[model samples]
Target: MTTTKPNMHAVAINPATWPRQTYFYYFTKIAPSGFSLTVNMDITATLAWTKAHHVKFNAVYLYLVSRLLTTHPEMRIGYLNDQLVTFDVLHPSYTILHANRTMANLWTTYDTDFETFYQHYLADQAEFSALPGPMPKTPQTPNLVNIGCLPGVHFSSYTPLPFKPLDSFFPIFQAGQFKKDADKTIMPLSITVNHATIDGDHLSRFFNELQSCWEQPTQYLA
Candidate 1:
């Protein structure tokens, strides 16, 4: 974990000026569950990079995702204490799959350096792998983005439903196993974000930007 305290000064959203003011009330109170969207992404570069470097695909992809979230501030918005606040830095709180098929939820503070982040992640992964019990609760931090990967199967369109109504604006991202598709290699990904904070415009830019980075591993690795 990064000992450095996060410089996470946030600005409170003025509901009066908030664009979602009209629906925000119902979305937060009246609606049983907040709106969510899931899309399957093609991650050919992810597969290729993992094959060439012999590194775990999840670790490498997480690094890329951390970079993406760092650049996209809107993706960091979260509702806390009946108010909306945008975080300056968002960290990862994801599931670590153990060899025994059990998984534990863990959080690792994000680092700009991929190797540094991966090393800390691996350490936590090792610790969690040794202890098997009920799945740990993911920390409910405003600065933590929810992430998990499913290496078991690939589906065309899959949506992960939350246990309870999610009023928070933070993002949830999931990756599926990579498989061969004709002459191309592809991987599946799903992103669920609170509609209050993210819209079609945001998703358009986000998907394009992430895909660009994934397709050019060497560019980002530098």
Candidate 2:
């Protein structure tokens, strides 16, 4: 007995330009044990590359992720027993920004596959551009509620962990398969995850797959 809900949201507007890049954040209760999970992902080259290429890096990233979701149906997050459960989608807790900026990262979670997710992102992008007022509303899991945002927003800075043996490496955990880039040795990503579904082993796999995505590509290659 599964149910579906239609949630509409407003896009994040640039303080300087009004409507540019937008982001959404949601918190969910992990399934099985229902432990609360928080993870962050660092799209290190996300902004920089997009700006240089004059390509919508955010759009490309979103398209790739959306495609991943479709190829791997089990990766989506859903609702169960008043808790948010995911077979595929891994909902992160904190927003990943560049150099600890006040601005939020432009990432999102979806329930379907890559193609559908990509189309959805495009549709939303058009809506944001057409809207007369600032886009408002954000997605919240389990509850499926809309949240508010502030106007004239700007980003703040964040600091990575200081040099420490434990801080040397971070873990990556995902549902399907992926690879890493060979040219780049250190790929730094901030991941947000649920405590109930994964342990250290799962997180480790995610990083490995993330690297795989950049390295020997399976599907998501630019």
Per-residue lDDT of model 1, residues 26-115, tens digit only: 655675343444555567776677778777777777788878987887787775566687677687777876678777777666778877
Candidate 1 deviant stretches above 4 angstroms: 1-9, 16-26, 29-40, 80-82, 135-140
Candidates in order have lDDT scores of 0.71, 0.33
Instruction: Name the regions of candidate 2 deviating beyond 4 angstroms.
Output: 1-55, 63-78, 81-116, 129-187, 216-218
The best candidate in terms of TM-score = 1
Which TM-score value belongs to model 1?
0.82
- Output the lDDT of residue 42, model 1: 63
**Per-residue error (Å), model 2, residue 116:** 5.2
Clashes of 2: 38
Clashing pairs in 1: none
User: How close to the true structure is residue 118 of candidate 2, measured as C-alpha lDDT?
Assistant: 48
Candidate 1 lDDT at 188 equals 72
All candidates: TM-score: 0.82, 0.40
